[model samples]
Target: MSENNKFKDFFKFGDFGNYFVRVFQKPDPNQKSNYNLRMMHGINKISIVVFLLAIIFWIVKRFI
Candidate 1:
């Protein structure tokens, strides 16, 4: 849990918009691994994509 490792995880997870990579991430043994954790991450990733798309669509519809 060092600051350096946190920085690495950010890029390792694919910067920002590519959060879907969590679906393919291997569970870290050091932390508690379970279905709920993985499922939550997957759902969160999907939400992020959906939210971004909605924002883009809204902006396009409003201005163009």
Candidate 2:
């Protein structure tokens, strides 16, 4: 499928992306906080992995 159609289907799926969009559509402040928390958790996990990879690369470079 084309990129546009693939993106359209992504929002249609009953998953985090759909739920996240629904939360943003609301006017509730609590929903916004929940969304932020979920996003932060995802970022934190990614950051940790990236940091570990960087450390491993540095260690390997030092020995080479």
Candidate 3:
């Protein structure tokens, strides 16, 4: 596969894209907003951050 195709294969699933999108992007104005929704998204962002840190730590521990 070409370099681009290989890179595309790595991200073939959109889970990673959705994760970053949900964390960094602003909420859609057209979508409904409420206290519970805000809290849910907030918690999701925190979990994503923690999960990423764990992955990084694992890689570092493995290398070291």
Please give, for residues 1-64, the per-residue lDDT of candidate 2 as tens digits: 8999988877675675465454444356554456777786677667766887999999999999
Candidates in order, TM-scores: namely: 0.53, 0.47, 0.72
Top of the candidates by lDDT: 3
lDDT of each: 0.76, 0.69, 0.86
Model 3 error, position 52 (Å):
0.4
For candidate 1, write residues 1-64 as lDDT tens digits.
9999998877674455354555556767898878988788878868877888999999999999
**Model 3 agreement with the true structure over 1-64: per-residue lDDT tens digits:** 6999999888776887867786668988998899998898899889888999999999999999
Alpha-carbon shift of residue 30 in model 1 (angstroms): 4.8
Misplaced by over 4 Å in model 1 are 1-30
How far residue 27's Cα lies from its native spot in candidate 1, in Å, is 5.1
Whole-model lDDT for model 3 versus the true structure?
0.86
What's the distance in Å from true for residue 32, model 2? 12
The collision pairs in model 2 are none
For each candidate in turn, give its C-alpha RMSD to the true structure in angstroms.
Answer: 8.6, 8.8, 2.3
Top TM-score model: 3
Model 1: worst 10 consecutive residues (lDDT sum): 13-22
